[model samples]
Target: MANENTDEGLKRVVGVSGLALSIVNGVIGSGIFVLPAIVGIAMGAFGVFGYIACSIILAAIMLCYAEIGSRVTTSGGSYAYVEAAFGNFFGFVINWLFTFGWGILGSAAVMNILADSLAILFPGFANPLIRGFLFFVLIGFMVLINILGTKQGIGLVKLITVIKLLPLLAIIIFGFSQVKTGNLHWEHAPSLKTFGDTALILFYAFAGFETSLGVSGEFKNPKRTVPLGICVGGIVVLIVYMLLQIVTQGVLGAEMATFKDAPLAAVAEKIVGPVGATILLITAAVSCFGSVSADVMATPRTLFAAANDGLFPKFLSKVHPKFATPYLAVLTYGTLIFIVSISGGFKQLAILASAAILLVYLAVILATIKLRMKKQDAGEKTFRIPGGLVFPFIGIAAIIWLLTSLSKWEILSTIIFIAIVCIIYLIMKKFQNKKPVETTLETIL
Candidate 1:
């Protein structure tokens, strides 16, 4: 693959506000609208603690990325950092793994939106064929927006982010007033297993905060805004997740588990009747679209970076002839989403996304350690990590704990990807070490 991309990728016009909203756009997807019930299934009323714990763990990772982001201003985000620290082969492997996760996630979003939209539009119809067609139409529509222009695409993200936050705000404002202390108390002592399991689920909600970090190359002040966008975005997410959970538990109680599919709307219905639920449904649809948009916008940049660097096919590096977007990479990702949406069940795709993301978290934390150690050895310092070495250790330990705590699919994918990456690295290195012995001897003589 040759490096044929001529356009300097996406133009750098999105300001701090756009980047921050893009972070919110990427992070606050359908996860918050629905995961409370799933979390409640693991630990009942104690699920709020799991949300907070996942936030804390990711906060540490985010700070590490902030420090790491301070150092590198490339478009690839985590992939670029890992490549600088560990070189290109590992970079390609992690990039591939991250793409798998992003694809599954994007597909999950597309399908979720399709299923929800179908229910809204044709309530009694449970036709798979109908839903599948709508999924392509909607997903393709969002991808086409990106193919048009980055500025236009991110503008859409900002709009969706603002619109989607309204229902959540309404939930917090209206639902908290109807609190019941009884629901906050657990029926039994919560098990550590339950806690870990619940945290893994909510971690999915927190997964996409790195959206801003991945766009560093497109930032006007790449070094300064990247850290601010990432840290501020993370803090905002942590606050929202906590409040959303608190009010949800207060409003819904034991039924949180019952309405696990669309818990926020269920909570809203309890707060303000049928109209509230409808509003929340509209919010859910909009929020999920923002997430899908964020995924479509961000993921291709990494793929474009990989392609530009020869880690992926060169054609993927080419900008769209008309739009000047990474149209090939975007389409490739859209195709992956279409396949995953139609072929695999939603639950399966969700678990695979979790596993794929855990691999990325593991890689980033490991890269942070490498960068931090090198800084220490050189007697150089940069952004202060929130708790210094302690934070990184906690972050690494947290990801490991979550990896073990996740479902069987999450566990297997994490292990398998790591093993395969190592094998690939070894084979490549072996080939590099092999030389033409006769030619070498003759040259030396």
Candidate 2:
């Protein structure tokens, strides 16, 4: 057994397949299951166009991350990249927004959504007390499994990923034969507001690829595999999401836009009957579980990184005495998740997270451009984005343009979130700079 004081850390046990699957798992959460109808309702016949546009945007962002990620071999992912390029303050801000919006509240949303999904099996799950109990249990389960070790946590991700994909694929395969092409027709042109809403929803669906980049330090050949896996994974997920949208939209037709809920299940029932819908519903719940588990595995690394950088409490950086995992960070995240899950206000956090991540993506793209300008002569074996500054520039512009589509409340929430983060950063910086004055008691001792 390895001792806590051995200084051993996370291992490079994850292979190409594991990294690729993690991306797929991270990106294809419960969001995709509901997006078919959401986009269909907004875009009408133009809905597929929105999917294509968002996929391009996401691909550009992922490319920036892939290139930047290859240059650094660290645990913090984007936070590490940004700090190395800009400075510590920028890194702390992004880390704080990410940890608060996505890590804590976002994961809580999944737990609540999973609890709601569980309500399908047991009607009593709709009760607040019972639902809160299950929510606590699920978050606890993820933290405990993760605290045991990375290998074990990733193993769970692999298994749940497979479980998450099967029903979606089944829907696509079977729903095709049952497609009523007449249902695919649109009756009207959507307004600009509709287009904006669809675009935002589509963009949010592709947000989780950073989960893999976070753990690139555990990849055997990060420079080569990180970029390759991300691109491959991005393409794979894009195809899956496109096919899912097409299949669900085709199967449900005009009715999709109004579903506001499990539109995919409605399509399943039309094709495969009640059993298929039940399977899809159960899979949706498990997908939420898988997503929350992925966050538990990846998000705490940001806190661990922050603590090491003196932005957070030192306790968050401690590796488990027996497991070598960032147990304290995991525990911290789990606790916040549990608290937020009880409040049931994750939608607001989800909106704020979506807004914050766009700015974060812009920062990463800028970091990539900065690194390239600096390392033009430093020949390193790193993954390079094809087409140079074109994609990075496009990514930056796209994110800024997308930010305009955010709801007013979301923009306000984002501003508040940033303000809070900056305040905390100032306080931490002051504390880190303060030297202990030798008191009389200390001098006497």
Candidate 3:
């Protein structure tokens, strides 16, 4: 057993800049690379409205997170906040929901995008065997970087984030000149259903910001960092997404639907020729890699936190003496992602991943309301949202509205998945001793 009184081996090294960049890396991922075409197909020149709608929804959710995260100040992000407000059962449920239901599945889907983008650049990647090998190498590489230390993991995220954005910024800057004014006009507004469905899919682009909050335990000063980082990072993401949508839609216009898989690359090819297409493809690969690396760096902390609270296997909580990281948790997470990615079943479940994340966000919003009513941090100087409960309610309504777009099967499957997670939690509790074992720092080294 580890010593509980000692501090966890994790170092508080990440600051606001790192956290903000992490949020950017998480939110602007593979979805943006392809979503332009999907939204453009659905809404034409008005497709940019989808980005605006999603930003509003995400803004509400991020406000709730900023408030609750300031008070909770722990790892596991949504899992930790909900557990503190509700109980261990709900916490356990959320941990699995966010970790496996959303994080792993979503990253696996993005891994497919990465592989496909790479295959465009290198034809050999088109082979199933080669793609599987690529998944193993990429996932293993991320695990190793994270296990070595959080700094290295974050450093790579920062580098790739910058690398991926350059090509995107270039398109936004140069492509607008080539956009025909005729392509920027729409005769009529899209119907509510059409708008809702497209916005629901675009929401996937903004879904992973919470994953960055999973490393609160390692944040240098979380109270200030959480709110500032989330809000600032969120604003940056909104701007980038909106501009990209405008440029992509403006450049490709109705023809965006022709290149469903790589809309941004098509836009690039139009603006700067074939060389531009090559750069955008490489950017897509790097952007996906950055998102997965950020996940590998942060999401494992949710597993580590859960295990320490006796909701997961104890081994996952063990901190490496030399590296001061949850090595086992990182390895486990990477392995799951690799399995799901190589098997290529995640695409079928992609909508389920979106639905699952909505549930997680709904839970967190409710947790914020509960925490506020209970005066959980009355004495502590924690960040509070400007509107008492208005934002939380907005977040709730937006999530519910978005969830309405799910098919009956996806909704039922989400319910089944939640029930299965709850059952597993109960079984673990039944076998646990009167006092659950808590893992802490084994040694400081």
* Candidate 1 structure quality by residue, lDDT tens digits, 213-277: 56555666555666777777777877787888777787778777678887888878888788877
Best-performing candidate as measured by lDDT: 3
C-alpha RMSD (angstroms) for model 2: 3.0
lDDT (Cα) of model 3: 0.86
Task: Order the numbered candidates by lDDT, best leading.
Answer: 3, 2, 1
In the range 295-330, model 3's lDDT, one tens digit per residue, is 999999999999989889999999998888899999
Give per-model TM-scores. 0.84, 0.92, 0.93
List runs of model 3 lying over 4 Å from the truth: 1-6, 348-351, 376-379, 434-445
What is the C-alpha lDDT profile of model 2 across 260-288, one tens digit per residue?
Answer: 58888887777778877787779889999
Ranking by TM-score: 3, 2, 1
Model 2 pairs in collision: 41-257
Better of 2 and 3 by TM-score: 3
Supply candidate 2's per-residue lDDT for 86.
91
Overall local distance difference test of candidate 2: 0.80
When summed lDDT is taken over every stretch of 10 residues in candidate 1, the lowest stretch is: 1-10
| TM-score of structure candidate 1 | 0.84
Better by lDDT, candidate 3 or 1: 3
